[model samples]
Target: LGFALTCQYLAARCAFGYGTDLRAAVFRHIQTLSQTELDKLGSSTLINRITNDVTASQSGVNMFIRLASRAPFLVVGAIVMALLIDWQLSLIFLIIAPIVGFLLYFVMHRTIPMYGANQKRLDRIARRTGENLDGVRVIRAFARQKQEDERFAEDCAELERSMLAAGRISAVLNPLTFLILNLGIVAVLWFGGGHVDTGRLSQGDLTAFANYMTQILLAMVQLANLIQILTKAQASSLRIAEVLETKSSMQDGTETPDTASEEAICFEHVTFGYPGAGDPALEDISFTLQKGQTLGLIGGTGSGKSTLAALITRSYDPTEGNVRVFGKDVRSYKGTALHRCIGTVPQKAVLFTGTIAENLRWADEHADEQTIREALETAQAAEFVDAMQYGLETHLVQGGRNLSGGQKQRLTIARALAGKPAMLILDDSMSALDYATDAALRKALAERQGMTTVVISQRATSLMHADLILVLEDGRCVGQGTHSELLETCEVYREIYEASAK
Candidate 1:
């Protein structure tokens, strides 16, 4: 019993240790993967690869350790004991063992492919579950609850059918093995009884021989169970390997960027297309921003404005030319140096489930209350934040679901400001705010002239005050100049300005 406890402890230690390490590694690798890779591999599949696959592998390790010694010992020991009891009765072991081996081989081989198919279907079930949970509000708002329920039911039904099919195949292994072994036991009694009558085998020896045969049968059954576990583990391992085997399409540079120079950002003849895209997203895009100036990107939907910003951030390297920061290629900037210099507010305001202070700390871990308050004030978020019962300690629900859209946007901006980055990127983040609030936020940013700013928006008012503005249309910059200059020379800019004035 003590030995068994020790064995269990060691097995648990190894399984959990490997699982933790593998999970961390997978999470880190997923971070390295580009958005393109994320698009190709959906969120649910990746979640399964990280969580479920690791669990299966751990279970496999536990099963192996538990059965590795015990199963073989029982089988071999039983054969030896049977031989000692009666040499003639031991022949039944030799005759029956080969047939059991053949059965195990046939079932195990057929079960592997089934397990693989079931795992794939399980991924679909996970995907549907995730979608239902995340989009619950949207479904309710659209009055599609019944339809969504039916869709989810369909997903579940298909998964259940596949699992049942695989399970039914596995079910056959036990009854068939037990039947063969019981028949062998019956044969042993008849043959051993004859020996006993002839005075060649005693009744006691016959009984011992039958018991040994039962041990061998039980051991083989356990081994068959191990085969089932191994099949599932093999499927899970292959899925995990697919993720580990993928190389990140984006690579980081070794060089650290110098941020003291006058030129904060530059793009020269840059053009890029996403993988498998028919046309380039950005065609020969070129721009520059001085260290203390504001650059605005104004474009219609699908005008490639966001693509240009991604180039500066080095989210993807340009297929044609160079994107640089501080007189060096953007690709040459090391991660810390690049991210430290840039604070980006994405189009979507995503907030984790944590206290307001906790979420703010993501931008700068060491930021104090005074710094955080100042950022909130600048983003015009101080009023509502202080109004909360717990103030900065107020807990935010996932994605800031408790707050209005405008409030969430302000908090997102404050989070970015807390970092005090050299370059601040506000990517159409103020759309939810009122005009008065928007104006106030812009005024606050204008006061901070030392930090380079890039504002991308469709509203001309958002970019009218910018030091330099670029008008994008169909992936090309048709105009580039100050607002007044573009109004006079560029027809596209004049038309946009004219329309906005209405």
Candidate 2:
């Protein structure tokens, strides 16, 4: 019993290690994937593959290690002993083995596909659950609780149906296996009893033969259970392999940007469309900004403002023409090299659970307290951070749920500023701030010398003072000039400004 316990412990430890290594490898690979690839494979599906699928495969490995050799060895050894005891009576072995093999094969063939479909249903349920959790506020704000609950219930119901369908097929294996073995045992009893009565077989040999038959039956049942586990593992491994084998669409570059260059950014006839999208998000866009210049991007919703910013960050390569930074093609800069030069505040303000100082340190791990405070001052976040009990040491919950919207936005901006990047892109990050705070942030940004800035905003007043303003409409560059120049030459700009004026 101690030996058995030791073997079980070793098997469990091996499986645990296997799962940890597999999850780590998958997570590392996911970091290499481009934004386009990530969008194509949704977060929920990837999460399911890395977690649930890995666990299933790990369980299979454990079971295989424990029973794979023992069950078959026992079955084969029992058959041989029965043959020696009475070769004629051992005919039952041949008939029963084939029938059991066929039954297992039939069940495996039917269940493998069902298991695959069941995993997909699981992905759907995961996706729904994630959507609900992430958008709980929106759901409640719109009074969509009932509708969302109903939708989630439908997903749960579908998953239940899928699991039940697979379970029903698998349930037949054990009972049918037992029935076949029981019938074979009855055959053995009848034939062995007749032989014993004629003195062809001893009563002792008949009893021993029956014992061997019982051993074979138990071994075969264990084998059947192993096959069920293997089938599920096979299905899950296929899913895991799909993720492992997927080559990232984006390749890393070796060279870094030249810091000495005067031109900060240039977009030359660049056009881009999302993967599997019907139309281009940006078309024939061309522009250039010199070092220290402030460029403003103004557009309505879906006008490709953020998409254009993504191009500068090399989040997705442009489909046509080139995007250059620091006098070289943006594609030539290595991933980390480019990221180091550009600090970006995305439309959504995301913060992890940590102290404010810890969050700011993400941009520059070696940044000192003075540097963090300076960034906060520039972002107009100093006032609030200083007022908090612990100041920069104040702890934020996941997504900064404890903070107001404007405060989160400011903190994100400060995190970006903490890096002292060569170029900064604020992608509508000021929407949460009041007008005075927005002006203060911009004024502070203006004080930073030789830092190229791109501000994407709907508020015309925000961009009116920028050195150059580009008006975008339906993915086209409709106007490019100073704010006053666009108001005169561009009807779209005039309409937008007039509306904002109201």
Give candidate 2's whole-model lDDT. Answer: 0.92
Model 1 TM-score on a 0 to 1 scale: 0.92
Models 1 onward score TM values of 0.92, 0.96
When summed lDDT is taken over every stretch of 10 residues in candidate 1, the lowest stretch is 111-120
Worst 10 contiguous positions by lDDT, candidate 2: 64-73
> Per-residue lDDT tens digits of candidate 2, residues 1-502?
8856776788888888998999899999889889988888899999999999999999998888777647778888988999899999999888988899999999889988889889998998899998889999999999999999999899889888888988998999999999999999999999999999999999999999999999998988888898899899999988888888888787888999876689999999999999888889999999999999999999999999999999999999999999999899988889999999899999999999999999998989999888998899999999989899999889999999999999999999999999999999999999999999999999999999999999999998899988889899889999999999998999999998999879
**Residue 245 C-alpha lDDT in model 1:** 86
TM-score of candidate 2 versus the correct structure, residues matched by position: 0.96
> Which model scores highest in TM-score?
2
Spell out the clash pairs found in candidate 1.
none
What residue runs in model 2 are displaced by over 4 Å at the alpha carbon? none
Instruction: State each model's CA lDDT, in order.
Output: 0.87, 0.92
After superposing candidate 1 on the true structure, give the runs of residues whose Cα lies further than 4 Å from its correct spot.
Answer: 84-95, 190-200
User: Across residues 440-459, which tens digit of lDDT does each residue of candidate 1 receive?
Assistant: 99999989858889998877
lDDT of 1: 0.87
